[model samples]
Target: MITFEGASKHYPDGTVAVADLDLTVETGATTVFVGPSGSGKTTSLRMINRMVEPTGGTIRIDGEDIRRQDPAVLRRSIGYVIQQAGLFPHRTVLDNIATVPLLLGWRRAKARARAAELMELVGLEPAQARRYPHQLSGGQQQRVGVARALAADPPILLMDEPFSAVDPVVRTTLQDELLRLQQELHKTIVFVTHDIDEAVRLGDRIAVFRPGGVLAQYAAPERLLAEPADAFVESFIGYDRGVRRLSFFPARDLSPHEDTVFDDQTRAEDARDIAEGHGSPWVLVVSAERIPLGWVGTDQLSRVPAGVPLGDLDLAPYGHTFNIGTDSLRAALDAAVLSPAGRAVGVDEDGRVVGVVSQDDLGTAIWSVTE
Candidate 1:
């Protein structure tokens, strides 16, 4: 656990970066510090490892005052991830991840072996081990950075907007990867981000900062969305707080229609007959293995050449699917909205199509939670 007792940072020019921060970051959970520019979120994070010294009061990790320890020694004990990844330009990916272990005097072979293990752990291909940081994609470099940080398996991690540099798709993927890692490692994490949505998705507890480093509100994402402590926090969370809160609600209450799913091997004439009976414009196409392919328009099936098999026809894009047993209502609703067929594809653990839920039904599920 990390505790801040009236901790503050004041620049030599009389500028305040953090002011009287009194909070407890729970062990083995993620705490995110989020706000706009000049709010001092980054500064507070740096204070944890003494990268940024506090001007007054004390900062303690597990009851030890961090200021008393040597700065370099303290920093090496904490895992830190920055926005740009900060990999050494000339180092091979494996060598980069093995840096800390090498510094700590592990044998060369052992360090490289550990590095190779981390590469797979962070979802990197083993072949990338020999490549340089420059040769990897921005997202891949970020994964290497993560692998390097976890090389020594530090119990506490400090991340400053680690995924912000990537595109939306890559950012979401990285976020998911981080969540998966956290579930296994259970590190005490202090993350800094300007994006409230990222904070909502990642934080076990969120600390909202205002200008001059004032802590506005610190609470769980659900409470932060359900009740803002002040106008500043409310404004920062934006008008979509209500919609965002829907993420906590499960989609299991949604009643999905199973008849909408059809096996790909079905006869085109039989599929056309089934489509006519359902009166829906689109039928979900699935493999014999029960995996979803895409949606086939009924009208298109009718126009197909008589001798051509149903599998020979092109399919309309299927947007995405959510696991009804695990995914949140927000994800299910998003799948519904994105689908060309006007339905969310619900899947089971094996990625097989279990059923389909309409957008109206999803909205009704949301209403059930909200009411």
Candidate 2:
């Protein structure tokens, strides 16, 4: 655990980078520091590892004052990842990840083996181990940075905007990878980011810092979104916070209807009757193996010959499917909104269609949960 007791960082010119802040980062959990630029989020993160010395108060790790330890040794004991990877351009991926272990006096062979293990742990293939930093993609470089940090097996990890350099798709994949790693490693993580969405997604607790290094609010992601500490936090979270809150609630509670679903070989006339019987304007068509085919409109069904099968007609795209057992309500809502038939398809783990839920039903479920 990390404890900040009235810690403050003041420059020689009287600029306050961090105020007398008091915060506690729990063990084995991700605590995200987030706010606008110059809000001192980065400054606060640097204080944990003594990268930025605090001019006032004190900071402690595991109940021991950080000042009692040598700055160099203290830093070596913590895992730190920064923007754009900050890797050695001249070093191979294996050597980059082996840096910390080698510094700690591990044998070269042992360190290299540990680096190889971390490479797979962070989703990098063994084939990339010999490649230089410039040889890998931006996402791959970040993964190497993560592997390098974890190479020494530090109990605490500090990440300063690590995923900010990548595109949205890669950023999300990296975020998911981090979450997966955290579940297994259980490192006490302090992550810094300006993006509230990223904070909400990865943080077990979020600390919102205001300008002048003031700690505005520190709470769990769900509470932070539901109850902002001030106008600054509310505005920073944006107007879509309600939608964002839906991420916490599970979609498993939602009841998906299978009455409007039909087999691809089902006759158009018969499928139309089933859809209309259920008061649905569209029917979901699935293949013999129960995989989602697409959506067939009642109008289209009527136009086709009565004996024609749903597979014979050009069906509208199903848009996407949400794993009802694992996904959240927000995911279901997104699927429903994008679907051509205005319904979300819920699938099982094997990608087989389980059922479908209309937007109206999803809204009802959301309202029930939020209320």
Candidate 3:
């Protein structure tokens, strides 16, 4: 655990970078420090590795004052990743990842072997091991950077806007990759990002910092969205905080209707009658194996020959399916809004259609959970 007891940073000209921060970062969990620029989130992160010296107060890791250890030794024990990867331009990907291990006097072969293992661990191809930083794409370089940070298997990992330089698609992929790694490794992570969405998505707990280096509020993402400390924190979270909060609620409890679902082999006129009886304008068509085919509107079914199977009629795209067992309420809502039939399809682990829920039902679930 890392504890900042009134820890603060003051420049020679008296600029306050951090103001008496007294927060504890729990071990084996990701804690994000997020705020606007010049809010001292980066400075607080740097303080953990002694990269930035605090002019006042004490910072301790596992009860030992950070000042007691030599800066270099302390740094080598902590893994740090920064924006744009910060990779050595001339170094090969494998060599870059092996830097720390080699610096610590591991044999060349052993270091490279460990690097090879980490390269695969971070989703890089074995063939890319010989490539230079300049030869790799932006996403690959970030992966190499992550591999390098984990080269020595440090207990703590510090990331400062590591994904900010990448495009949105790549950024999300990297975020998912980090979450996967964290689940397996359980490292103490101190992540700094100006993006509140990234903080909410990745952080186990987030520390919101205000301008002038003051700590605004620190809490779990769900709580932060549900109840902001003040106007500053609330505005930082944005107007869609209520919607964001739905991510925490599971969709498993949502009741979906299977009455409007029909086998694709069923006659279109028969399916149309059943859907009309259920007061559903659209009906979900599924294959023999229960996999979702698409949606067939009752109007479309009525236009088709009475004896024709639903499989013979043109069906609208189903949009996407939300895993009822694993997905959150947000995902279900998204699926519903995007679906052509205006209903979200819920699927089991095998991608088999379980049932479907309308926007009204989703709204009810959201209300029940939020209330």
Candidate 4:
């Protein structure tokens, strides 16, 4: 949807921020621009909506040269969100969110209704509309800003470190929310961030820029992690990107043992034998209908009657678990982190016991990526 051809920018001070950049962001794709300070990532993004005019070359939006488009009309058609939310302090949240649509000549009632719908879309309450920016938390303010950008229902959005000012937990929430919104809306988006992890997590394709705005690599997260362009890009993505990539892979890869699931009716002694046979202390408990129940250790069965209910004993934690049949490596890693014990359990979609994936399985996945 967006293409940059021989784009370059130079400051009045003669510092080259970007040079001869040529790139394409697939329509409706979340293309992230990432780099350190002074890399020109920010400047390149600004040129998209003409916030920063390019010194040379043409930028095209769906094949029409953006330079020829009227700045006011072009901007109104392209949504923009920036760091710290950039919300006006005196404005009510609803008014702030309705800013873009109102500017586009939408009726007052129509704009407000649109704003309310967008607020709900971003997971905010309609009651918060009356609150001023000062009254809302920083995260809430960011949501308001997002709602405002989306207020006009523009075909494109340019977000510059939009989630950076908030706390990490809130930032993650916003990232996940953006992913969900993108999946539904599919707006052509250009996102800028300094954090590599954030770029990888959110970007459909990442453009890594070096000093002077050099484009190092533009590729999918897996491709970049599996094969970085050079030392600079490799260092930027971090040495552990391969393992970090696991978050995208489903946790179902890890499988738990098939026949050892405990349920409400199964005798405790039998469960113990199953666990003991594996040389493990516990077995995953499930319903007779194959839903997850919890877990029980073999040691606990010695204290109970032959038919002692699986639910009756002091239940162990549910095994570090995920659905099996997806990717064992992902499940194994989650299990390792969640496990107080050594192994991770796997359950099927129906919640029935499936198999187990161990740390060794995790090792193989990580090694394979690097190798």
Off-target runs (Cα >4 Å) in candidate 2 are 303-305
**What would you estimate as the lDDT of candidate 2?**
0.95
> For model 3, what is the error of residue 314's alpha carbon versus the real structure, in angstroms, after optimal superposition?
3.2
* Least well predicted 10-residue stretch by lDDT in candidate 3: 297-306
RMSD, one per candidate, in order:
4.3, 1.7, 1.6, 3.1
Report the lDDT of model 2 for residue 349: 89
By lDDT, the better pick of 1 and 3 is 3
- For model 1, how does the per-residue alpha-carbon lDDT over 71-152 read when each residue is reduced to its tens digit? 8778878999999899999899999999988887899999999999999999999999999999999999999999999998
Clash totals in order: 0, 0, 0, 11
In order, candidate lDDTs are: 0.91, 0.95, 0.95, 0.84
> Taking the tens digit of each residue's C-alpha lDDT, what string does model 4 give over 218-309?
99987888789999999999988767767666654433456556677778898888778877776767677776666666777877888777
lDDT of 1 at 355: 91
Candidate 1 clashing pairs, residues 3+ apart or interchain: none
lDDT, candidate 2, at 38:
88
User: How far is 345's C-alpha from truth in model 4 (Å)?
Assistant: 2.0
Candidate 1: regions farther than 4 A off? 257-321, 336-361
Model 3, residue 25: distance off in Å is 0.3
lDDT (10s digit) by residue, model 3, range 114-144: 9999999999999999999999999999999
In candidate 1 the C-alpha lDDT for residue 188 amounts to: 98
TM-score of each: 0.81, 0.95, 0.95, 0.87
Q: Give the distance in Å from residue 115's predicted Cα in candidate 1 to where it truly belongs.
A: 2.1
**Runs off by more than 4 Å, candidate 4:** 264-282, 285-319, 325-328, 348-353, 361-371
